[model samples]
Target chain A: MRESDKDIIRSLKIFSDVDERLFETLVTAAYAQRFPAQVDLIHEGESADFLYIVLEGCVELFASSHGRETSMAIVSPVSTFVLAATVKDAPYLMSARTVDPSKLLLIPSQNVRDVFDQDPAFARAIVTELATCYRSVVKSMKNLKLRTAIERVGNYILRLHDKSGKADIVELPFGKRNLASILGMTPENLSRAFGALQSHGILMDGARIEIIDRAALETVSKPNPLIDDFRS
Target chain B: MRESDKDIIRSLKIFSDVDERLFETLVTAAYAQRFPAQVDLIHEGESADFLYIVLEGCVELFASSHGRETSMAIVSPVSTFVLAATVKDAPYLMSARTVDPSKLLLIPSQNVRDVFDQDPAFARAIVTELATCYRSVVKSMKNLKLRTAIERVGNYILRLHDKSGKADIVELPFGKRNLASILGMTPENLSRAFGALQSHGILMDGARIEIIDRAALETVSKPNPLIDDFRS
Candidate 1:
């Protein structure tokens, strides 16, 4: 393995406590690949071959039913996606596609399972990672089921502001259309939702958003830490 | 361990391949309890202490945000809930309540973690269980996001029909209001959704449902295996 790749592997939380020999075996079988924007990385119902960790750029996980699609998540760098499928030796549950020119490290799923069987620490780490992902998805479901589209928009903006270190203006990570899908609304509904939130003091201009009255918007959004705060 | 409890444990797919020693250890650390209907079994935000396995009756997993509550899933007998939190030693993301008089086996989270660390077979079992759960949640999220409320209601009825051996009439597992909450809708909205679906040839009376035209309702629901089928 390249020294830089080794450094990246060593830095991952999933690999941190793994024994040196198992880590070396895992890293040896892993390879990094670059994909252009809109490349389909994995498809739902396809055989699970590799566990993917994003090294750069972003990937969008989505699901489609009867030609209608809904975005599930926007996976960012330094994190893994699809570990559940890899560990279970099951088919991928969601389709993944690159949102930009992205770099991804792909570890053979067989090696992952083998290492998990041979190393207790790696098994524990897998449990931790899967649990976190599971909980995050639960929270996402809560956000969808408990909140209205307008409230979801409000919370999404508030989350972005907090994520960007409480900036008065937060730049969207993706386009408004993609944001609409991720937030579980039509682009038209997203536009209307933003307009509706203007009454609570939110202003949006293309990708830049300004929270004129955080308190009022918070009232409208009702962003509970249990549901909205990923870190907590 | 009681013979009955051992039989129950042996029947679980998650515990099927577990080592005998580890299984004995797990059963020794486990105890079953019964709760009356409408009783809260586990609350959100509380530290997870036990892994719950439903032995008889039904449990409802739900989340509350602000003042509103959303029913997440109807966990039936012979299944487990909150495994993710127990595995990771994290707080419960959703509160669990009994929908009927229910029997549950409570295994100390520490014992689960210990056995998981010591027994490779148990660890593998956990991976399979967690992965199945993670995929199930992913599918649930897809259902919530990719389908409208009426479509959700329609598809839910269709799923129940399939589950009940494709009977023309299917029994409701729980009350209509609870089913409404589970599908992310108001009871009023559920009524309206049912009314909307009458055109698609669905009929509901109390807890009894009849699909007058399965093909017509199926077209409206668009049940995709990727999003709706749990076994897929």
Candidate 2:
């Protein structure tokens, strides 16, 4: 059973591309845990005890403002979160709640960082993960600071396409209100942003959003690493 | 001459506590270059050519929208900016321009990284620096999305106090407009924000801003990372 679970972890990007020995060590250090929907796995400003990997269901990451929460990212199956705090041994800046019945692997922070100290390649892998996290946050900042609401949703559709293996007709990841917070706007504003984009040729059908005229949409919404459409 | 410069490099937090021999290797690898104010040293979306240490003067890191630019960080002498770009071997996300006549020591991208590979302690140093950068950006994001304009200015004054070594009379490193951008508001809004904070009992005379009421300010402005209070 342990060997089969090791095989499961072997498929994750952090472990998948690495040598068998490192994968073996990581799997040995990490153990699987589970959570139910709406469960607060890690409270904002709480102790940094464990780093989590979502093996099933979904999680919402958010920060609070004036008692209201703002969504940052929604993590689905096969992704890690809360690492910035875990690695640094600092209190989490954001709280995470399970958005669906979930299965996770919680690696004790000390056990995880011990791998960093014990293995150079593993250290390199963690560095890559942190760098990737840093880039994602930068992209988020660019999205929030550089683009207005309408362009953000338009390009968000493009990103959804890209994230869903660059396929057509991927379902929406989060509910509209959560997505609005992630996009740095209110839900009413997000609905208006979507309407404005639709009038400009981007179309939405229930959970599925489609770019009817990709070129015109790109022209209308200038994209960059923020929007992931540079020429726009 | 080398010894004096080593002393200078040793004064920087990023390099000050580094291994002496590794520091010498970096010193040997670096070339000192001077630039006039307003010259762009690094441009967004381009390969980062060199990792720089400003030996004199200041540089502004700013990002642009449809021609509107927002100042990101005002990097002063003896500090390193863009460490993430150099360490991660990625294109810079923002452009850097000289804000004052500057002498900067340029360490080739390859050299900074190669040094990282050769010395584990220096590699640890680099990781610490990257962590610091990530934390600062995270703090900036909190300031942007969570805090009110008046709260931001009040906290900015507290930050300035720390930046000036807890000194009461502190001259700012950047012009008000640039600082305003970094604080994530229009210059006029920044003026109003400062005015609001002053009305709330924070006192200012020229660049020498003072926190007359600490508890009131703390109630209004959030402080995470106690390191802000511990400059040394």
Number of the top-ranking candidate, with lDDT as the measure = 1
Which segments of model 2 are wrong by more than 4 Å?
Answer: A16-26, A76-78, A164-168, A226-232, B10-25, B162-170, B204-206, B222-232
In candidate 2, the residue pairs with backbone N, CA or C atoms under 3 Å apart (3 or more residues apart, or in different chains) clash, namely A222-A232, A223-A229
Task: Pick out the ten consecutive residues of candidate 1 chain B with the lowest summed lDDT.
Answer: B223-232
lDDT of 2 by residue, B1-232 (tens): 3667767777776676667787877888787778999899988878877898889999988787666677777787767777767867888877899999998888877888777766655565666556656655665676677766777777777777666666756666667888788887788998777777776657766655676776676677766452233221
Per-chain TM-score of candidate 1, chain B: 0.96
DockQ of candidate 1 (2 decimals): 0.74
What digit string (tens of lDDT, one per residue) describes model 1 on residues B1-232?
Answer: 6797788778787788888888888898899888999999989999999999899999999999889898999999778899998987888899999999998999999999999999888898887788878888898888887788988999998888899888988888889899899887889999999889988977888788888999999988888877667674
Q: Give the lDDT of residue A66 in candidate 1.
A: 75
Give per-residue CA lDDT, model 2, range A124-230, as digits (tens): 66666666666666667777777778878878887776677766566787688888888888989988888888876567776678767767777777766633732
Predicted complexes: DockQ each: 0.74, 0.36
